[model samples]
Target: MPSPFRLRATALTTTALLLSALATGCGDDGGTDEDLTAQKLSWKDCPAPSQAEGGGSAPSPLPDGQRWQCATMKAPLDWNHPKGDTIGIALIRAEASGDPSRRIGSLVFNFGGPGGSGVSTLPAFGTDYDTLRTRYDLVSFDPRGVGRSAGVKCENDQQLDAYFQQDSTPDDAAERTGLLDNTKEFNAACDKNSEKVLPHVRTTDAARDMDLMRQVLGDTKLHYFGISYGTELGGVYAHLFPKNVGRAVFDAVVDPTQTSEQGALGQARGFQLALDNYAEDCTSKIEDCPVGDTPQDVKDRIAKLLKDLDAKPLPGILPRQLTQSAAITGIAQALYSKDFWEFLTEGLEQAYDGDGRILLLLSDSMNGRSENGEYSNIAAAGVAINCSDDKPRYSPGYVEGRLPEFRAASPLFGDFLAWSMVGCTDWAVPGAADHPDVSAPGAPPILVVGNTGDPATPYEGARKMVDALGDGVGVELTYKGQGHGAYGSKDKCVQTAVDGYLLDGKVPASGTICA
Candidate 1:
């Protein structure tokens, strides 16, 4: 299963196909000191996305006819030894469209995933931020060890197919052994294929790269729009260079205070809450609920279906079966946004009839698998970055011991998430810290937006992030909405507050609510 923390803004569109395309080759390492900061990027017309970046055609011109430009920024391969070796950080941007007098440098974006390709993602959602583009160059990038920027590689497409299909929620010691063996094999593949880049892909490293990017972009301070794991990255940047932070926003915020195990437990509960909300919304509709008569009935039926799938898998996409793990993943994917609930309803309806294509497609989206059976490096990078940043290496025994607590939090999602805690087993690199440090006493106020119905990062994490970001640093904004993020939900109040802060430097009052 993919990490619960992975958030792709465009994964819900199944019709979108990614063709096989050439991967972006890494640039040569640069020499020391002043030369690096003074490096000028050679921006050009953006090309079709590479296979590792989740292949797709080049971004279309903006509504106003401005073409998206792509470039590579050089940063030290290892921050500890800045003069030693360098790696390229892929970037995409649309220059500010408004008056020259109003231009406010760049507004960098990181759309979570810790593994997502922002070069590809920013184009898909470019229009959503056109208002902000009036005053800032809308920019986003694929962080180190992600897409085109020294992307991490592990397992072939075929290997990944079997890997994701294996029963993640093990039933016995034999099944447990198989799961561990598979995880070890995947980790070994990453070590073999991307050994040079693994140790340098931590969030702190990415934060440092952003500062370098700020210098290269000729900006006095870093202006950012971060979501999900990006929030953690932004917080780290603030901690490292609080005075360098310009106007920024953290949506779908991750809790910086929780350890890996605690984070997983929170996700189990968060996903369960989203599921409950989804079920309630379905049943409350005037139209007769197709899945069940009541919310409990809906959940009970889903539990039964999962139990049945554990024994006899349903036929899904060609040559693949919808295993219990895939179904759970598909369900989790749908729960990310309320807009996908109808698909979840349809997927469940199809599964009940012994057809599993829809649900499997959802699973594929969650895993970053393209229609052509090619997968981006999202899973590989997700595991690598997660393993490198998280200090704990959970044993199967440790996971087994915590099953009941996880299950108590979410009966449907507990086992899957609990088992995922062992993802870093036998990792090539040791982790950096117990949890990320986001404390920034001197940073500017960052508008922190939290969706009450977020399935990946729980609602409570918003407050935790605010508290962890230190006094007067994090400005909390609540959106009583559903989805992985509040801004993308198109709530007028939320967008207005964010636009006001980013475009006009008018921060909304702390603890402001948007319903």
Candidate 2:
């Protein structure tokens, strides 16, 4: 799904990366050396989520059960000076179900987003991993700039509400000026409210925190399952401590090889391809589909709707109107999973009938705007982490110059996605990061999963990631399906490959395809 805060990947087939894992060296200290010691975690029961007051949706509630233990860990704000200004890393651990004597070690899970809340994400899946849960404690943490941890806060609800309602697909100089103005406004809000934590929340810092968590959890090596953007985190961890890398799975892999602009174009094409796939499915499955029989027709219809919305906003569910931005977001949200296609169809059908409540609602859902008018910090954190992680340089003229290239990439969704990068131009901190060179020479075998029809992270990017990690060390598992992620799906082949790797150190043969 194209959240205003997520990253993108593209198609560029290359040779698989392979290099046998052999004993090698430790990572060069990026800067300072302070003692890296584990901190004690005082586990306590988690409080029940605040109930949604009246109508609309709240984010999915924490799953019931007392199996969850909440704790906070102290980590340096500056990894170079570990003893200096510390920040809290919030963690949630679910104990294993099998015999205590048979227990393996802690299994760390990250659900991408650079901003995704592992504390919220873990509980929904800890039980579903069935066998793996019994053998190891499933633990997840809110990385420094996310969830209960020291988070990045930007514009408040009122400001963001108005921001989301702005027309993203600007048609003229005036609209373009407004778009850039809003970008600067949001950027300024983040710098004003989160200056202390913004520069410190880089991927390297989070990877360093993971190592400390492993030490605290008493694991000799790290066993991790990271999806989407999480794959980048896993890659960084493996590169930093190759010897400490145990069983690791990087699913829906992001190519650590691409620059930010390349990644954007890649995602533009990927989302376009996914929309085509959705169009094909709709023509065959749904009766009287509004998108039509061919992909081109679908693109044309969507383009027309966006143009119309740009010219005149539609009446929506509440005070806000359905602007081009929300319409694009709603469409992109459904493209993430095939299961959400029906909702997309309903939303489009309603829009066709001159009522935009469904599409507007879906957009709000994707953006994490709560029913009671409060907004989640996800959008803020997402922008903060991404901009800090990779400093994007694009003026309005520069981005405008790339418009034709973007539209050529994806006729319906390209321009909006490409222009979304403008906010990073004025990012407060000059990014001191890049995609980490992830060929960890002596790491244990790492499995990378790719979905053939994934929209957010393209299949080709997965292949490229494997190539970057090296062919000998990285194994590719393919799911011939549609979705942004492969694991936790009903695909038995994927489940078996992932489970076997995490539980029994079983590696799927090279070129393993899971349909």
The TM-scores, one per candidate, come to 0.96, 0.91
Residue 205 displacement in candidate 1 (angstroms) = 0.5
Q: Give the best candidate by TM-score.
A: 1
lDDT of each: 0.89, 0.75
Tens-digit per-residue lDDT, 125-156, candidate 1: 99999899999999999999999999999999
Worst 10 residues of 2 by lDDT: 10-19
lDDT per residue (tens digit) for residues 305-403 in model 2: 888988888888678888888998878877777766766777787787787877776676556565456666667777777777775567778878898
Which residue ranges in model 2 land beyond 4 Å of their true spot?
Answer: 1-36, 49-66, 290-295
Error of 2 at 436 (Å): 3.0
Name the top lDDT candidate.
1
CA shift of 475, model 1, Å: 0.6
